[model samples]
Target: MTQNPPIRRALLPATALLAALALAGCSGGGSVRVAAPVTTGSTAEQCAALKAALPATLQGRKLRDTTPESANTAAWGNPAITLRCGVGTAAVLDPHSPAYDLNADIEESGGVCWVSEQTAGGGFRFTTVRQQATVELTLPAAYAGGQSPVGLLAGAVLKADPVVRDRPFACV
Candidate 1:
């Protein structure tokens, strides 16, 4: 029986491959980074909750009075507070239309509409109306008073209403 020469593998190529893998491990792998959980619930409840949960800094802060007058189209958050929703702007379904008129006084809009609330901090936030079954909610880290706004909002909503539904709201 003839014994074949012991197969010898190249060490340089193997070492290079190992080094590459180690470098990749040191860097970021193909792993996905999971963000904080987004809570979803009734649009109105959530809105009211967030509004009531606003920190002291934002509670009395007067935002630009740009809320719409239409009951259906208007925002439903704290009457005194305002967020930068950029309302009163005309909608543009087609920007390249031959009749495209930027000077039109008509008020048109798009996207999920809803009332906005001020964060515990100075930032203003709002919840998007759900065209479907669920609405996503991102809680701020702290209010202007350095407190979690989500918990406060949730508590307020719960206290105000005995039974709060996690369903979409007709506000939008």
Candidate 2:
């Protein structure tokens, strides 16, 4: 039996570890799956503008590619802080809609207002309030105790989607 060199012995473990990590990453973890919203005409144009203005990173997470590859959707991080532009107005924001909530906590950060609702998964989904083209963000439960991620995208959203003056909802 021949003994392997010290460097070769060390390289064997490292190489094996690398291969294992690569396989783990290939098992449906590389890209996030997000439902893309349908938009047309001016809304589609606004979504495109918002996409262009999005930051390359959010919080400390580098932006990752989303599945289905839509210009209307973006994501960041493993748990994924996802954004879908040109979404339909949520019922909570519609005064005439039965789902409207008079006591909704409309939060304002970085000059944009949002209506947040908790999801069944313990995460939170926030939608832009009173914007021409609604933008929705889904924050994973892992981010619950952290600082608000909304401020990071505020500038982009503010520039891309003008406020709908006719809408009754507004951040107090």
Candidate 3:
């Protein structure tokens, strides 16, 4: 009987990962399905629009199917880049007393503005500043790179709802 070469077997995992990534671009295949962020009424409507505009793939990860199938929340990749729309005001948003100093923690990237805070587990929390129903995103430390989630989320949402950036606040 003939058998595959050792080198072929060694390449299996890498081959599988590439296949999965290609599938992700088609649908949110490789993404982790998370519980939808809770919302009601018009808030839900707004989030739905944001959801509709979210990319099929994010940061080389697919946008996974979320639990409860809600437009309020989304996740991508294994480490799980989670994004929640229609979020309540974050304590750091208080311009009078920001959770962190200006431009230090809260900075703009890819045209999206956010206030960042490190999670206890060493992950990061990035929340939108100018939008009405705040959008919060969480990413693991290893995912840190030039490709910012802020830019992606903001582009998707703003394109869907041009006026979503209501109630702008200054972190001065």
Best by TM-score: 2
Q: Which candidate is the best by lDDT?
A: 2
TM-scores across all candidates?
0.22, 0.82, 0.68
Show where candidate 2 strays beyond 4 Å. Answer: 1-29, 95-99
Query: What tens digits encode model 3's per-residue C-alpha lDDT throughout 34-136?
Result: 6566788766777888888899888787777666577788888766788888887666666666453544466766555677887777778888776655688
lDDT of 2: 0.87
Alpha carbon lDDT at 15, candidate 3: 99
What's the TM for model 2? Answer: 0.82
Task: Give per-residue CA lDDT, model 1, range 72-104, as digits (tens).
Answer: 111112332222111222122125655334443
Cα lDDT for residue 95, candidate 1:
55
Q: What does the lDDT read for residue 81 in candidate 3?
A: 88
Query: Could you give me the TM-score of model 3 versus the true structure?
Result: 0.68
**Least well predicted 10-residue stretch by lDDT in candidate 2:** 24-33
Ranking by lDDT: 2, 3, 1
Against the reference, the lDDT scores of all candidates come to 0.33, 0.87, 0.72
